[model samples]
Target: MNWNQIEGNWKQFKGSAKAQWGDLTDNELTEAEGNRDKLVGKIQERYGIAQEEAERQVDSFAAGLKH
Candidate 1:
């Protein structure tokens, strides 16, 4: 989903976000403030992944929800 859809459903979507980025704490996700870039950065920082990989993971997660 796009950022608007993600932000609109932040509470519901956060669980999936946590599942995808298991290393990220709830506080980090909250601190991301509905910004995709910040969320990806947090995931990268917490999981030690490269920026491109983190973005890909987030994109993949979003794509999975389309099914």
Candidate 2:
């Protein structure tokens, strides 16, 4: 999904995000302010992954939801 969709559905999406990346805390998710880029950046920072890797992971996780 795009940023708008992710922002609109953050409540539902957050659970899956947390499940996918257990390192993130509820506070961080809340503080991300529904911004996909910011959320991904936080994930990248917290997990020490490269931007491309973080994006790939997020994309993969999002794609899995379609199934």
Best by TM-score: 1
Q: For candidate 1, lDDT tens digit of each residue in 21-64?
A: 77889999888866789998998898898999989988887777
Pairs of colliding residues, candidate 1? none
* Per-residue lDDT of candidate 2, residues 1-67 (tens digit): 5767777878878888888889999998887766868888999999999999988887787667641
Runs off by more than 4 Å, candidate 1: none
lDDT scores of the candidates, listed in order:
0.83, 0.81
The CA-based lDDT of model 2 is what? 0.81
**Residue 24, candidate 2: alpha-carbon lDDT:** 96
| TM-scores of all candidate predictions against the true structure | 0.87, 0.84
